[model samples]
Target: MTAHQNGTISAEVSDFLLNCFVRSPSWQLWLSLPLSLLLLLAMGANTTLLITIRLEASLHEPMYYLLSIISLLDLVVCLTVIPKVLAIFWFDLKSISFFACFLQMYIMNCFLSMESGTFMIMAYDRYVAICHPLRYPSIITDQFVAKAVIFILARNGLLTVPIPILSSQLHYCRGNVIENCICANMSVSRISCNDITINRLYQFACGWTLLGSDLILIFFSYTFILRAVLRLKAQGAVAKALSTCGSHFILILFFSTILLVFVLTLVAKKKVSPDVPVLLNVLHHVVPAALNPIVYGVRTQEIKQGIQRLLKKGW
Candidate 1:
């Protein structure tokens, strides 16, 4: 029962079979344990960070608000893709309905973009706090955080909506087997029978436009922050500024390095093993989610103290 019948596209695909790691079935068992732990760690850590920020009066500032936004995005990304991945690994349930697959695609795209945008915004927060101490309170406020939230939501939501919609419009006469754990845009689009030039171009353009711009801005933000820190004559001031930004710097490096490697390998896909990008793509979801709060909790003294207070109260 092919969707293409009599040399014409006739029927619609009801579901997609996710061919996740089909090249090595035995690896599923080996991968399942760590993946499960990572998922649990991500869910628990992000939840705890969000709850701590909400309860701690001292953490109600603009910077912590932005951190909470990032945690929320990570939580959404984990929930959107990881459970189904674990299902495929543990239970061999690899089928996804058409609508469900597209919904997953949309969430992954939207939330990932939001996460990147939030990082850029957080860099700006650091930039202002370091570069212009007198203006930090006036410039970065609760209202600013609210407006940034709106901007991230609207920018990513509007742009990402078209991706899934355009992908769904393509005729899937070839087959409905997406060869990845999650319904990535290219994975789903590559299976379409129709000409997908528009889809490919739009995805490439939209993705780089969002991510590239954010990375460039973050770079400049840190550049200015570095200059300001170097200018400070006080030794204690220099150390404090760098310490404040070290956690963010580490998180950003991890986030962007993995993303850049994945994109490069995917673009030059002929040069690399097919599983490399797929493996990186899957890891990108959980690794960052699991590490983000841990990085913050360990590096940011205020966050560590807040968590300690939370634990003490709980006990």
Candidate 2:
């Protein structure tokens, strides 16, 4: 009789936990439709521009190569998160299986880390261009740029792998209702029955370490760039230097702000509106995807001219 009572109690607890994690229906699906369309359009424009740049021989340069890499990363980042979000909205798959959620979280972090690394490399490129103009060609050679890209790819890829692996080992006996539309790392971590102290600690360590290093390097590079720009005799030279760094600077700022906000939202103990994080995460992903193409289109004379010519040709 005692054994039978224990089994009944366990079953009741399991049912309650499942209900807690199950996604509730809402009218948010209608809103996601238009947002998803906008995301699709932005992704298409960015990919198209990136492909055109790559195919055109004249567009081959360190800057354009970096831009191509950024575009590709942006594509992967959006593809990783937005589709699942749209699917959730459409199908109301509120409770993702544990494995699927971990995969989604892993991929999103991988691309995000890659993007951060790419921006750091871009800052170094600008530093060389502005501060070491005489040796820019030799220092940032095609071979060197390719190697740097490979290193960035490897570093981000390797570093992010452990996060998902660690997350997968955790046992989730608590409710799994992820407040956000996407499977965010912190959201997943919060649902674990086992003590998540290590997970949280690792997250903080990883977040601060990567972001701190990148930001510091970027700050130092920009400092050198500013000094070099100030030393220039001609206004035109300073203006051109500023202009060259403008798009990259804007992108870095946008990426950094979004990342910081997301991280903060994750770490905060006090619960804010769930929608706030969802909106911020969506904006964080979508805005950068949209801005990359627009920034390049507006700021790059060659790209602008190419776009204009293409439009004129109706091709």
Candidate 3:
């Protein structure tokens, strides 16, 4: 990444190189073992949850439906990130075609936003069920879930389209070496010789706006839910009331905490190894995907029984 005195060699990049770990090849290969384990767990847990949800007639309710969507999104996110990461870590493949880089960038942006939106809606679901238990059935009907699915799709799909589109317009003549494991938007844009003000501003706006609004609404939803729980008559009544969303709240807590840690690690990068952020970024995708289904399984009675029944039936 040394500068040429002439400053004219940056626009020639036809393919981009990823700065996936540059340690010893053997070191990277050894690191892949744990990463591979995480990918397998994510795929297995989510797929099992999805299948069980589909097979269990009793789980046809809206709550399990939304949970199934979560499992599906987690599976998609895990696949979108991990296989290429494994290729880079294990096989030392770093070069990504220009088109492929932009495509991956688009998926990363759009899907992550959609998943965040999904979490927000899930919080609203809990809020309604807790605050207005009598109307839960009518309010969270199949049609309502369908509308939510459409909103999640339309919101992120529209906002994130510009990210990769604008990125693809950049002139990457300087170099292709992305200083990160994945085809992150900034990682690729920073290599371009062209002015990246538009790209940077758009991404910053898109990410913060989408995630910010979702987090805010989710916060208020849970706040009301907590208020409702505290007003119950007896201690047993309070616990019973909380059980309606106890599982969702627990998973959401874990999800948000890990995500916050990842953001913190980025801001404090000077205190850690140069490689630390990249490692955290890579783990951020897979670890959550792997953890979601497992946590849900433990906390949810119906899903637990569903999983047990599946095992007994040897499916």
The lDDT values for all models are: 0.90, 0.74, 0.83
Note the residue pairs that clash in candidate 1: none
> Considering every candidate listed, which one attains the maximal TM-score?
1
Put down candidate 3 lDDT per residue, 168-206, tens digits, no spaces. Answer: 888777767898889888878887788999998998799
Instruction: Pick out the ten consecutive residues of candidate 3 with the lowest summed lDDT.
Output: 22-31
lDDT of 3 at 180: 83
Query: Which segments of candidate 1 are over 4 A away from where they belong?
Result: 1-10
Q: Is candidate 2 or candidate 3 better by TM-score?
A: 3
The residue pairs in collision within model 2 are none
TM-score of 2: 0.87
> Tens digits of per-residue lDDT for model 1 on 101-155?
9999999988998999999999999999999989999999999999999998999
**lDDT, residue 251, model 3:** 68
Best by lDDT: 1
lDDT of 3 at 228: 91
| Lowest summed lDDT window (length 10), candidate 1 | 1-10
lDDT of 3 at 298: 87
